[model samples]
Target: MAFQSKQSMTEPRDRTGAVQGIEGVLLANRDRIVRFLEVRGAGDGAEDLFQDLWMRLTDRRSGPIADPLPYIMRAANNLMLDRYRSARQRELRDKAWGEASATHAPSSETSLISREQLALVETAIAATGERPARIFRCFRVDGLSQRDIASKMGVSLSTVEADLRKVYAALAVIRRQFDAS
Candidate 1:
């Protein structure tokens, strides 16, 4: 007789497999998620929120999520709200007094670079041709995947991807120019 462990069934399909799957999902959606937050002034913590969302998704405490996409958006939004509250406090301090009185410290150079990268992304998004720009905004800014964007726009996923490629190419050009300058 073969013995099967009870824990095996609920163990994330396989530890490495789950991690890989989650990583892939994050990579596929990360740029768009960060860009979405960036345009909304949450750019400073976009990557952090992205990481946090992935963490929440992978957390055993939450158990299995029925729908990961909606869950991710909700998590992202909540994290963004928390970040906004903290930022607002800093802003108030800076406004009432000055940088000297500000208790909240600024983040590191890497974080600043991330924000700059997001800015370049936005510039590129804006520069894209009309339909592409709209599609990119729907996907990147709204935190909707290509499938969701396509469905909402009444287009195909391939069309959404084509739009993204154009936007990405424009962003590359913008990033290069920004780097040089």
Candidate 2:
């Protein structure tokens, strides 16, 4: 809890005689912080989140924090929560965007995909196999959540996720072929 001298105040928390910027403390604990983030559900984004944390700390006036490491870590956790909320909202918006305008007819303006593109997409989806195609339809066309689709299809959640991945891989191949021509 002791304050370091102004000269080295920007250094890592462990150095007793001096204090440094929050950035220094964060840099010193980079591995630990990123590991914490990974364990906290950041997955592959932990490193990116660490960089973002640095940027967030950049403009703030350097002040003597009694526990700089934990303070910054708490900030990272908040960032993750904010990210999760933003992604959830975006998914909700996308789902709502796919809903019927009226009479179950797709809105042309909303879904501007050409008939040719739709045919390509449908063919690619069907090529994945019956289960994957069904899963794709249940999730995308039926607008059911993966969990709901799994329950309805009598499959495990992981099975649903696996089928969706297969379907997406086929769709990716279609996209590449389409882009080439």
Candidate 3:
């Protein structure tokens, strides 16, 4: 029998019976995998998932899988699910922490300083002018977006942005004076 090439024997083969490295197979199918992930609701995270797949494939040593496409797709799906679960857990943990912290009252000195700071901020916003003060209240107190403020006030978006900027500048000056004192 003729001597078989060592390279041919050692190289991984796909379901098609063609010899290819796992990396080569994965690289060739990268675009298809990303598209699959996007369809599965990964959106802009498709590329990131693909990179994770690449790392997983490269990091492990295993025998040639008869069909890697399905395997890869499964891995991507699992990774996406893991990320979603992790994000949900993190959000819950943060909410719980925030609630815990909110229950604690500040020290008397801290409360007094906070009240004084609020008074200074209010004074600074009032000094800026009526339009700026209203815009500042709409944003900071009402938590309205700039676009909402502009639309509600029948002003250009730029006007709203400018008002906010003026308010912010005045506040910065007040803050600097307070820090100096």
Candidate 4:
């Protein structure tokens, strides 16, 4: 469904008194609801979650909530929690698939190609010099940030960047060799 901007989703109000329904209360506090989602670590998905919240409220046949604000907030929180749980479940499932794949043997041709690629990469890294090789491993394999790599290596940020560039250049040469072969 199309999501409206906060300004476009006008507050639910009749002329008589307080906004009565959950949908009305949510429309009135859309910005605040989004903020609540953000605070709960929805991050970039906060707007989508807010829209989902709106849809759920509209689709359900609920009576007017006496305290719509708190009710809406609780609903938003529950939505975020559900999203988080679903994401986590997805991650675990993917991880399981990956682990299972690691136990399988490749075909002879695939195995040969993988070994050749690994040898080429090792050779390239070695030819790039010790400092650059170490820096590349630290950043890529160890998952260290550039700043962290520099700090750990007792080198300047520029040095870490330069080393990474050198590693990239070496890899390019290796790639060319592979293409020629």
Candidate 5:
């Protein structure tokens, strides 16, 4: 989106021009900001931080900036750093709390349960032996299309289709188990 200058640079009113100039950068850099956060630290909260940055930028209480682009970028960077520190502090505090409140059951018991369920699934797939299992995993779990899987596995498209049938059967059994549960 184009950043329309609401007023001249010399205007005495709110620095609407300055803020509007930065709006384009903000819009274009959203994905870049998210990727930066996802890679550097705030993988889970990148979107939240992005929203917060916009809120801070748009807040009327901040008044007009002399040069809004650099100011907003600096603000975003500072916010990300603050988020990283806060997350680390929270993690440390949670760890200490867990140690103090230790019980017979660990906090990761649910994760263990899920892992066990996944292992059961693997075992079930193992009953189909290696090739079909690999094909099923490549096409399903890895999200490859049948044609792509066939090309990668050096197999015919028909073979890929056949393997998909086995995958469907296995998944139907798994779905039935889930439904029964």
Candidate 6:
């Protein structure tokens, strides 16, 4: 047919063996592949992944595939999965970096971990005896001055000071343990 000759003249053919069929199938299924990626949570990166698929498809030498469509589709799915894994890993790395570099604010707020810390401090302070524990609660919780705390507890100012020093020594040991862990 003269029309076949004219068509062949107008269109370029693949000089390479298997790439010709793959490129043809790729071009035909590009839209489907992109949609597939979006549905797999690729979002706006679907187009980028499609381009990646194209580059990767042509990356290695291969013989002709008996089932090019499934092969190409599987490759696209695998590419999306690879992207997901890489993004997940990046997020975890960034979170770990942020936590490691963040300033430690022990008194800022209470979370579950802070509750455990509160328990530890309570245990250490309780070990100092009832007088020191009451003194600590009055000074830190009631925001009372040391002289007022000594007056309220009917003790000398130096006794109050000594009780506070005991509390401080116990707390400093807990601080060292927290930092080491």
Top model by lDDT, which number? 6
Between the candidate structures 1 and 2, which one is better when assessed by TM-score? 2
Better of 4 and 6 by lDDT: 6
Clashes of each: 0, 7, 0, 0, 0, 0
- C-alpha local distance difference test of each model: 0.67, 0.75, 0.74, 0.74, 0.68, 0.76
Off by over 4 Å in 6: 1-15, 101-181
What TM-score, to 2 decimals, does candidate 3 have? Answer: 0.42
lDDT of 3 by residue, 1-181 (tens): 0122233356444423332455777888888989988888789978987888788866665445556667667777887777776665565456547778765333323122356788888988999999989999999999998999999999999999999999999988987786565
**TM-score for all models, in order of appearance:** 0.39, 0.43, 0.42, 0.43, 0.38, 0.45
- Candidate 5 residue lDDT tens string, 15-90: 5654664666778777876776566566797788788888877664433455555566677777887666566556
Pairs clashing in candidate 6?
A: none
lDDT of 3 at 90: 62
lDDT of 6 by residue, 23-86 (tens): 8898998899889888987899889888888999877465555577788888888887776656
lDDT tens per residue, model 4, 64-181: 3556677778888888877776665565456547778764333223122347688889888988999999999998898899999999999999999999999999888887776465
Badly placed stretches (over 4 Å) of model 2 are 1-20, 100-181
* Tens digits of per-residue lDDT for model 1, 1-181: 0122344447545566545555566677888778776766676867776777677666634233444455556667776776776765555446547546454455333232346677767766877877899998887778788888988989889999999899988877876775464
| Deviation from native of the Cα of residue 32 in model 3, angstroms | 1.2
Residue 111 lDDT (model 6) = 34
Ranking by lDDT: 6, 2, 4, 3, 5, 1
Name the lDDT value of residue 76 in candidate 1: 72
Off by over 4 Å in 3: 1-20, 101-181
Cα lDDT, model 4, residue 37:
94
Write candidate 2's Cα lDDT for 78-153 as tens digits. Answer: 8888777676555545655677434434333433345789898998898889999999999989889999999999
